[model samples]
Target: MSLLLEEISIKNEHSFRSKIDVLPHIEVPWHHHPEFELIYIEKSRGTLVVGDCIDNFNDGDLLFIGPDTPHIMKNEDSYYQKKSDLRAIAWVVHFKEDSFGKEFFLLPEMSRIRKFLTKSFQGVRISGSSKYKIIQHLKTLHSAEYSQRILTLLQILQVLAQSEDLEYLASDNFVETFQQRSNQKLYQIYEYVSKNFQKKIELEEAAKIANLSKTAFCRFFKSKTKKTFSAFLNEMRINYAKKLLVEGRLTVAQIAYECGFNSPSYFNKTFKSTTGKSPLQLKGEK
Candidate 1:
């Protein structure tokens, strides 16, 4: 779905904003915020949509999103059921690079952090000891005073800056497309494809949705997204397929049909090529 632009609410007393949430599900929906975000998911098992990247996230997952990045944490539908006791808990911290001051990161001591912030533009996944350290700080901030909270945050960044275990979630090619998506036409196309991808989606129809001729729309989409319409649609379907695999409620063949692949063999091949694992292997990971 098209990511809604979200306005993060930060209190006047705090230099940066934070929210600790416990709910039946992560209901934030597909959205984007201008502030850089650090999310520590203590409890949840579901899909993560970051830029053109699709992956599963479980308890202890830590994610860092750069400014203007599109992302969302969509929990399994079962968690949203009124009869279910399942819940998703998370701590999210948000701040701009200049939250401290315009010149803060330019200082000598902040060199490592400055570089870290730049690398985070593509979104980052924290792993190993660095992930645990971040969780520790987030857990402590739950009860800390305002002064202590900000201090703890700074410490967390220092650890992140020096940590060795990290993964860039989005590809460099896709990251380059971030700024080009401000035009509302891209959002319209994204929303349409997201909704209709399970059905046969022709480029002509996609062009109609974008209010352009087929040739023009194709060029525009490729220029803005760094991917062709068909490729993007495949990615979206595969993302949903991955989510279903994680759920383990359906066979691989059933998943193939459900995700719009015409046959099991083609689906398996595509899944393996896109994710570097067969559907069965991905299911095992879940």
Candidate 2:
């Protein structure tokens, strides 16, 4: 499926958008934008999808997603029922990398934060003391005026930069797959893989989608994502296999076929190589 491109509106007087969303349910769907997103869940319970990662989220969860990454925080089914009284509340902020200034992040003083921003491309989950500090800043940010808002956001980034209690949300290669969604060719390639990974996908077919010769497409895809097309496809399949393994509903062989692997042995080998754990081992753990 194609992801929607979301347009975020920033006030004329402000360089960034920060607000608290308190609603019976979330209205946004799976969408992406060309801005960095920082969000803290004040109160909620749901599933969060970012790039190739899918996991549960609870109250007090904090997340950071870089530009052009597709994401969604979908509430549980009960929250969508008309008679349900549950509420989803969160503090969200959106800003561009250059929102502060073109040279702001390039300064020597911003080295750590600059590196942190790069890591955000894979999405981040902040926890422990860092989440606590960032949440306080997020609350202040929503109501701060003028310069104070900018300062608070900087403080949030500073905390994120120095903190050790952090976990990356998306797979390493998944971010590269969607980081240039605005490019039509890249979007077509990503969409095609996302939709048809459960079936046989030939390199020639993918080359045709990109309108390039097979050799040119292979080199182009490697240049853009730093991996061979086959490797990328294998990672995609392995990621899905992991999710299915976690759910504990399907047998390993069935999951291998479901994820488009030609054989159970090959699936086991690829799964172990990619994640450092065999499928049955993961299923047993779950």
Candidate 3:
């Protein structure tokens, strides 16, 4: 299945401005647009795919995605069980860089905002104190009008520009491609891997999903994601193991088996190689 992309629209008397969309329980498909996007996710938990990066997000997570950055939010199974309990809300603001005027970003007063927008192309994920501040500003933007809303938006940008806890999520060679046709095969591979990563995934099975021979599929997947199939699967399993450990419920041996490792010994070796810590040590650290 191909990823779905929805275009957010805004209308006003003066101008057909694209007002920020405050979406709830909406699963955004992998797509890109020309407008820069600032998303404040509240009471949500899901996997966020930004550019070449794939990571999980929890409540209060904020992300700044630049123009033409292909991304989406995949809600977990729990998000759909009880709609009210899901409580997934997001404040998404979209703006064109040249909407204000031709040299707007060049102004000295707008330096911070300029920097923030430029840095967003690298895909910024904010956390800690800054996250709180941004969330507050996002709430203000939802209700503030005229000068107040503009000021609030600028303040949010300034906070992001100076935040030290911000992490870039996109890869170094992050190329923005909007070819929906090309993504069909990629999405198929992603869906299969995401669903079956817990168990052993044969190269032949993955190749069949892409409708290519094993050799061709290997080259294609690596060229697109910059990681081998096995390497990507290992990373996915390790990430799940980390979450299980943090939950503080499972023993190391149990976690290994649950995470689909054939043996506890191999799981330990892989965990140490990837995280530089034994499974027990990792659990204890948390």
Against the unseen true structure, what C-alpha lDDT does each candidate score? Answer: 0.83, 0.85, 0.74
Residues 1-286, candidate 3, lDDT per residue (tens digit)?
A: 5445557565552111324444446667666677778877766787776755657788777888887666767877776675555556667777778756779778998887787787688688889999899888887877777677667877887898788979888655444332333656776676566556668889999999999999999998888777788887787678778878887898999989887898999999999999999988878878
Top-scoring candidate (TM-score): 1
lDDT of 1 at 269: 91
In candidate 1, residue 215 scores what lDDT?
92
The digit string of per-residue lDDT tens for model 2 on 38-143 reads 9888888876767766556788889999988877667889999979999999889999999988999999999999999998988999989999989888888878
lDDT of 2 at 208: 93
* Global local distance difference test of model 2: 0.85
Model 1 over residues 46-144: C-alpha lDDT tens digits?
A: 877676666778898999988877676778778878899998988999998888899998999999988998888788999999999888888887677
Q: Of the pair 2 and 3, which is ahead by lDDT?
A: 2
The residue ranges of model 3 lying beyond 4 angstroms of the native Cα positions read 12-26, 51-54, 82-86, 106-115, 173-188, 257-260
TM-score (all chains, Cα) for each model: 0.84, 0.74, 0.77
What is the full ranking by lDDT, best candidate first?
A: 2, 1, 3
Clashing pairs in 1: none
